[model samples]
Target: MPDQASPAPVSTAIPPHRGGLPDPRHFDPVIFPGAEAGEVWPPTHFNFHAPWMHEAGLGFERDASGGIAVVRSFAHLRLLVDIETAHQLFDLAPGSRDFRLLRLIPAALRCVERIIPGDPMPGPLLDEEEEVPEEHHLYAATTAMVERLAGQAGEEGQALAEAMRRVPPGPGMFEAAVARCITRFGFPMATVAPLARRLQRLANAHARVLATAAAQPDYAAMEKVVLRTRQPLGADRGWVGGGLLTRAMDGLLPQISRPRRASTAILAAAEEAMRRPLPLEAPTRLILEQDGYRDRLLDISVFWRRLSAAWMTVDPDTTDRREIEALARNTLRRLSLTSLYRAPDEP
Candidate 1:
């Protein structure tokens, strides 16, 4: 035998489990090397376990901070724990000098398990299968989203959504008309209620201020109504009609006086009082003051009413659930990110 080749040095390196996650049913405790202790693993760089697998994959990974974090992709629910918390959570043997990859999977699953029902799959990620809605399913989802977002604000938030939900048929023509304003925006069902209530209150308050303006033009009292009207539907300030008011005031003030009197005095007064202007236009004030053109002003002021009408609007034959979900998810995300979107001060 010509120089029998020495047995090739046995390689001990283990390749990544890219074939997809191992079957949890047959999983065994995988003890990590003691030497790897205290060394941080990069994200998705599992020392032992693979990522969690679902239609979307699941698994915990070392987050950017090099600590273990379990995240539910939908709703962005996340739980972070330190080494000791992890040990306590998984009932790891004290002083074992090893980490078990299997322990983290349950942790990750628990994170997903905690998501509120009807919350969509986490987004900016691919859309997940949501329940197909019935005739008014979009409305239901919209209300559900409202409840969740409001609940996040505290008890007041919950009460607000509920109150909006129970709002009886409008007491008056204007209120009823206000309630229907958001209808043409293709906003179906209860989703329109909260927004309608918001718009209604603002419109009523605006009408009062305008009425005052047309008669004695009580800048002081009108200012108070305009200021109060700026309050948002819930704790989410962004949902308020402040932007709508400003634009309306801007248009109304310039054209308010017959000869196009510069509205600087009224505008300055509104800016001083409300921190923004009122949502009143010359025509709306004239209509409210004279009790005419109610329908015309409503048609004009319901935010993109004409644009929605002119477009090839697809009426919800059933329900465009995904669109409602996307709206809810995005709204919640923005509210969460907004510095001002916080729980109301405890009474």
Candidate 2:
């Protein structure tokens, strides 16, 4: 009989059932051998799972340091997904938003390997050439690519097609926009933490003030007067202006909030924001600021083959135990691998 080599080691795959409603695991667990254990669920790697299946046909694995790494590097072709697992934590402008925040996803892992050459983070692996947007060519280019993905027949192909349908409305849709940013210009979030935190605190305090303003009788009358101003209805001018005016309308809500019932709504939202804090740059003031870093892993070639197979094997997902625990270790090893990207001009 002809000699046969051992079957290649399988890798970890992001399964179909994305961690649902009440629980959104925004990161991938490194359920591989020798991975780390932490309170962090969904180690951001899984956030780009869709793009992996759709594009590279790969899985997850561990690095030299026993961290999680993607099997195949990201390609510029096919569905470009950017999982924005952290952006919602603040009131970031539509302009400066990072879109890679979802859970159970697979995205371009190259960015994680390319940090600037001299920087502390992973350099060559994450540093891609800067992308200059071609606003005029945007629509035509996006439509063409979206159609290509949508045209596929199988469920996997169809899923990518459907997601492409909901490309997020904006000057540059969400998924593609995220890729362009990270691949071309990676985000530096370590320093962004303090500003994000302070902003969050202010938002909480403002909510409290709003609650107080809501209860006062005089504030109601003042707000009524502002409504009659008959100003133009631009996005901000009308709604937010009215909101601001009403709050300051003799400060009824603020007054009512005395002994302030920071009503459960804002408080809950605030807590959620904190729990899923955006990956803002680590603050310089932080005791040991890990200022900037990439989102994925290095040498995913070894990591993914072992990971995807394992993920496909025992994924029961009971809250008591995530079936993908083995994969978590792979993710942990790469946590220190420095997720950076190669310059677009490289090869």
Candidate 3:
């Protein structure tokens, strides 16, 4: 017996809760469908000549000289979508009755509405609107684009300024455009895998409390999911207490951020940190291929994952119950292994 010290994987063993629930929960995990070896998260990439989150709300910061910056703002959106997907998978599985895409789709839509005020280009994406939707939720894109198309003055760069001046999308229209983006993204599945797994961990722990209420026919778990959708583990600290992921991604208000680019020294230090390796054989080496900021961002993001994992496990009180603690540790360890190595299939 090779140190049966580590317990069995929860993925394989169904929880023998033995409580009065009929039928085992059938969850065709929406997190990521396949063996865990070679999944590529395809970081926030999208179909566009220009890069921008179609209809998402996030924080931003600019420099003294003025320039564009992208922020990591999808955490909340990721979790709600993750858990909702989890709920559907566990509740409906495949071949079940019409589980009502309306149910989950609308809930996911609400997340977009609540977060994005107007479908204004998330950040600098405000311009470049070639074809305006016959009707777009965030017409600011149209306004901005029209301005740019109208043209900038010889000296004023009036086009850019004018585009920035356009009013944002109406509140009502915001949801429609974001809905379009979700349809395009096909649910935040790859992005939110970490989130879904965290929710699985949470829903499992909250079962005692939630199950009691779930037993009541009129119980409102959907609302709970709405209000309680926090960012997942290994998320930015700004996510604590309901802060937006963009706030974290934007890297603090302009007043307080470090000189990221200037410190070639820091980038080098961080880059060197990546020279080491992690366990298990993943299949993608994304860092090697990404150009410009993605490389630095990946390094920072990977470090955050490593640092947080180390800290979270130390405080056992914060961990799942003892029975599942080992499983949780094992699961997290497997994920952490990804941070150390470029997966074999990242090309």
Candidate 4:
């Protein structure tokens, strides 16, 4: 007989105790639909959008047959099953996380769904609105597009659309409308993708510096500096922090009452830094101490604020629209992918 490979050695070891409960984080994959024995569910993309999803006791992975498996962790046990089974369980146990995840599906489907059929927009028309400046034209076009999309979404969409229409036209109104749309119909990725991308870039640029500051023992002092900027300096207050003597001391300090623009920039940088995940490393005290570091933070802060204001106003002429659109698209795509519904059939 041909030589046979030696049998693999098997070692016997006691599994670690998990506080009197089975470790939901690990399980035999054989029992799960389409999963091979001993496989663990791969992390899903949605986890990045909302890290709390994992904390809320839900997980996702693919089985050996390449089918998605939904894993629910509860009371220290994990139940792995097919999507349909998962949905049924969700229906029976409907929690806040379940509803939140469900909301993403309809919102994402709204994007690719062929509601109008044929052309989403018909041939050019000779209308007064067309005569408006390009910025106004694009803004109106995007707004109209959103209305049409919401109209096709049925009762819920219509209600949201109606609420949006009630808001007066302007950046503030648009901001309100966008907020309502997201809360009711999820994000309108097609419209807001550019802005989201810009925010992501801004977030990336400051992540390291912010992480460093966060790790320092005197980080709280930095926060106080950033927070104090929100209040404008006034003559009535003798001293900024305490009394007349302190005010005199502040006047003697060169950096005290820094230019409004500088303060604004720092505030903006702080806000953006708070929005995303930070890297893991020892704090670089030298980086925080450098004048160049402060300058860089200021520059980014100013740029981010302008970008944000433009977004709120829907300034069509702003060069940053591309980044905004990209951001929106990225967020929408992620939400769409991780949603509960299967991919919609291609038309």
TM-scores, all candidates, are 0.17, 0.16, 0.18, 0.15
What TM-score number comes out for model 1?
Answer: 0.17
Off by over 4 Å in 1: 1-84, 91-165, 168-347
For model 2, give the 10-residue run with minimal summed lDDT. 289-298
Error of 3 at 51 (Å): 45
- Candidate 4 local lDDT, 1-347, one digit each (tens): 99999999887644532222222222211111122346432212222233344355454444455334444557655444543234355552222233323322221221222211112221111000111123332244335433453545344345445655766653344456556656666767554433323322332333433422221122122223323322233222433443432343233233222323333444345443333233211113222422233334333222222112112211122213233233233222222322111121111
* Model 4 lDDT at residue 69: 44
CA deviation > 4 Å runs, candidate 3: 1-156, 167-323, 338-347
Cα deviation of 232 in candidate 4 (Å)?
Answer: 44
Better of 1 and 4 by TM-score: 1
Residue 322 Cα positional deviation in candidate 3, in Å, after optimal superposition: 6.0
Query: What lDDT score goes with residue 38 in model 2?
Result: 50
Single out the weakest 10-residue window by summed lDDT for candidate 3: 210-219
**Cα shift from native, residue 9, model 2 (Å):** 47
> Could you give me the TM-score of model 3 versus the true structure?
0.18
Per-model lDDT: 0.31, 0.29, 0.27, 0.32
Cα lDDT, model 2, residue 129:
24
Give the worst 10-residue stretch by lDDT in candidate 1. Answer: 305-314
CA shift at 69, candidate 4, in angstroms? 44
